[model samples]
Target: MSQMRLSLDQLTGTNRRAADILLGNDRGGYTVPSAKLYPFQWNWDSALVALGFSVFDSDRAWQEVESLLSAQWDNGMVPHIIFWKEEKSYFPGPEQWGTTDIAKTPPTSGITQPPVAATVIERLLAEDIDAHRDRAAKLLPKLDRWHQWFLDARDPDGRGVVAIMHPWESGRDNLPDWDRPLSFIDTTGVGTYHRRDTDIVNKDERPKNDDYDHYMALVRFGRDCNWNTDHIARNCPFWVAEPGMNAILRRAERDLINMATLLGQDDIAARATARLARLDAGFEQLWSETVGGYVTLDLRRDEHATGLTSGSWLAMFAGPVEPARATKMAATLTYWLSQVKHGVPSFDPNHELFDSIRYWRGPVWAMINWMIATGLIEHGETDLADRIRRDTQALIDQSDFREYFCPVTGRGGGGTDFSWTASMSLYWAA
Candidate 1:
């Protein structure tokens, strides 16, 4: 039997539809993840969306990133969600974050998301250095400050890896990797709060009520502390070192180091080089031979959280694992791929906790697949990488641009016309 592939016409249609999604979601300088569901410009979503815009609109791509950076806090931490303007649709709104006094301009959430901007900037710059050099030059120091903020605030111990105070920070909300650590958090004072997400999307497709309870409780805790890192680190109940987030930061540091060197920012390059070394060594603590892949560390408990999720595969994308470990991860990934028609379920499909329709438990995210495939290619797993790319394209073909797809059914779930989904599809189809 011959393998299926997207025809030239289909590829062109995909690109056009993806561009339309970005255009539709565009709100002047930045793009929202989705119109009604997300509304606000998210930290990581904008970074990824910028990459998507770079495909056809270079100016818009740079604008997307610049808008996101404009919300950077005085302390250098870029808030996860920048509320350029208030929208009633989103819960845990700017008021909940209480960052008006602390955050810049339009206000933002107190927490930061996975730092993917540096990596995205590097890619954009590589595509057209002359076109983006000046923009990259101006953004370079701000990006450096953001990374340094992580080192100083999240990794006060200089552990090479940073700890995420909330699951949202890892950008893998409701991931099973956080189950144990989140369980330790008490939601006694969470109070009554309505979640706009469940109201807009299917309740089953979103994080459970209990998850929201814990989420808001943590939000309140941060609000109480004025979103101070030292205070949160000292008292927050949910502190975990996520492999996926660390891998992202590690990869971004590598990219940032290159960007700094290219832009003649030697001091920033040297600092990032040293930080990358620490991150490379830090992976040792995250690896679990039992799981046969990297796992999240419960920083509060000072123990490894046992679970094999898609995040475990991000180490491949981050690219510092030993050859033997990378080989083992490839084999393990192959085994996981075999369990479902679609590739790279967020949670191992075989796991009892796996929920195909749920937000993150077992959904197949295009962004995850793209990152994993890129890592595979870097690690010389070209065949596996190609397989993932094909799977990703198949997912997009089967379902339009949605937040995520069910690995078992290839049906879209969560918010529709998702910016990052469309962004990744554009890249995959290209």
Candidate 2:
């Protein structure tokens, strides 16, 4: 470990305070992303939270992963929002997302977010195999089912690349990449409903009103389909193949295969290996030479988004790309770092739709930085990786653990005392 990592392990007043923030956000068995902006156990947020817990409390870390998977759907698809309890602090609650048609699981959003559970599980196990083995046994089969669900539902065409039926599924609720496909969605059926996100975070920091309209429009569509996976996949108006979701899923699938191998589950290992081959080939369809990074394909329209965002940078992190492709991506990342004080901006600053404060459009998220940094390190770009870690640490220290940061100004934006931001800070410090 580096000197900074040694210092982090020593536990200063700052570390104690960061831990307090995490504990403060802990609702009970699980932690919410935050108190006001997000009041439920979110899929991806819980995975990241597990990493932070592993830094100090390994048992709590494993429990966090266990709690997240406790709500897994029978089909293996882990719903995005697991409404552990009712809270009116956020919009599109359990009532809004009627998942009763899907299964008798906990109240959850019909659509799933990026699957990072396997990746988190692999990391925790790396810290202690003997301690996490039994838990890993329980999780591996469910994870295999989840991966199977993605293939069966999202990649029906056998393109190897899965499609996101809703923007929220991408975990980037309103990225410019979806603007084109979202426009085609009919919000006329969306009844009178209030948005609770704007109530807590700045309106400028959230998705635009039009984006929300389409978001709700898709929600209504899912509900109309009765949350039937086959029905929704066949008829959904919006279908975006996001690089971030693809990358995360790719990494998770790879990790799950490794875990499955250790557990003597050869069936899952074989299936995951086959899926990896398909994903490797399908990536060609999403490659955008003009953008200098992999871009998303609006599968519904059979069109590709030209805009480059943080999601595109995630391709390298997902897995190895062609050396030439990785070299170009490295150049692209270096170019963006030159444009802003921050190493990665959510969207390219040169793009007309880029917004410094608005969520997903153009903000540097700590979680994203941590992921991109890890990718950079794996690709042997240690300088950029170190820069990202340093920048993330400095920004969090200056901003007091806000949700995201302004890439150009290094100022915090969105909800404060955020769980993932705190989680990333602790990881970066270590």
Candidate 3:
């Protein structure tokens, strides 16, 4: 399992480059995923970007989270994108969201991304508790409320798992897991709107126009409902219980409980424990022996979304799964690894829909690799974990810090100098 380690000079060079990317992307308190492509501060991006900042500037890392949390909605749900300043480069801007009245100071999209903040905060505090203790204390209650919002708004049924109303919420964008659910969404009246992403990156490397139509339709629906969770839940056609999003939420809740316990917040810890128990039980619905991995549950059809995605492996990372299931997932991961030069393709490389150059179809993202490897190590699948970590570092070394790399060719794709890509390189690629 031995792999090449970066020489002292190489290690310093990698860290310096990553730090420069983080600093270049920084916009006051928050960091953008990319300067031209994303422009706005994204939910999960900031959380991961904070980790990279912690490596060089601990104080800046704390400010990143604080700035993101400042835009939390009244209902405890954090918006997926915060329109901190006017930016015309990206599509579906603040006006498209039509949430000015409801959103906080800068205004934001109504939808929420994965809850990676609590897990990230715990890691930050662990690095330097004495310096970050006060920040963690203040963030815990807000994080608690944000976690509770999932239970109240997204999973009103008290089903241990929460449902993502939009693909953007999953943060995988064009993942094949949403294909079937997205197909059911009617884009008849989505109307005309320009997309700025394809303008910045090759359209071939980005999501198809058909995907955007469905995405925009969902956005319009949310806006029409005034971003009301209850209304969207009762009527929206695209409701899915995604394994990846749930795993992230579950892991965050687990970490939140630990953070609360450390901060002596017994009440927060107790509530998070109850929430985690339900999530642990409900997560079973996502497991599909048919796919040999955890798949998405289309709530509308009451059936599982058929596909083998990198997300399934997240269950192990977010686990307490039975040993048998973890072994099965590990085997599936190994099979996928054998099919590509880079490990952990976003979608199964053998799947008919897999396209190595397309975003979230079959590309390898460093952030995903970091999580999968971390989960593998936790489950004692160190050999496979090391393989993934090695492959990830190789991709970065050969391709530079791009948004993602082609699993088959190891070529970089999407936006260049991506924030989370650089962040993961610094924090996990070492």
Question: Which candidate model has the greater lDDT, 2 or 3?
Answer: 3
lDDT of 3 at 105: 81
lDDT of 1 at 219: 91
The deviation in Å at residue 219 for candidate 1 is 0.3
Error of 1 at 232 (Å): 1.0
Write model 2 residue lDDT over 1-430, tens digit each, in one string. 1212222346666565666678899887799998888999999999988777677777887888888888888788898999888788899998878886564656888889999889889988876687778889888888888888998899988987999999999998888898888878778877778999888877988888888889888888888778777887789998778789999889888898888888788988998888878877787788876776789998877788988889887887888877888888888788888888875789988889888879888888888888888888888889888988888877877777898999889889988899988887776643
Could you tell me every candidate's TM-score relative to the true structure? Answer: 0.96, 0.96, 0.97
Residue-level lDDT of model 3, residues 1-430, one tens digit each, is 1112232234467777877888899989899998989999999999989888777677888899998898988899988999999989999998889999999588899999988888889998988678789989999989999999998999888777788888999999999888888988889999999999988999999989999999999999999999899998888888899888999999999999988998899999999999999999999988887877789998888888778788888897786778988888888888889989998899989989999989899999988898889899999999999899889889989999999999999999999889998888888775
Give the residue spans of candidate 2 off by over 4 A. 1-10, 101-105
| Model 3 alpha-carbon miss at residue 280, Å | 0.3
Q: Rate the local accuracy (lDDT) of all candidates.
A: 0.87, 0.83, 0.88
lDDT of 1 by residue, 155-231 (tens): 98887789999889999999988888888888998888888998899998999999999999899999998998999
The clash count for each model shown is 0, 0, 2
Alpha-carbon RMSD to native, per candidate: 3.1, 2.0, 2.6
Query: How high is the lDDT of residue 130 in model 2?
Result: 79
TM-score of candidate 3 to 2 decimals: 0.97
Q: What's the candidate order when arranged by decreasing lDDT?
A: 3, 1, 2
Residue 90's lDDT within candidate 3 is 94
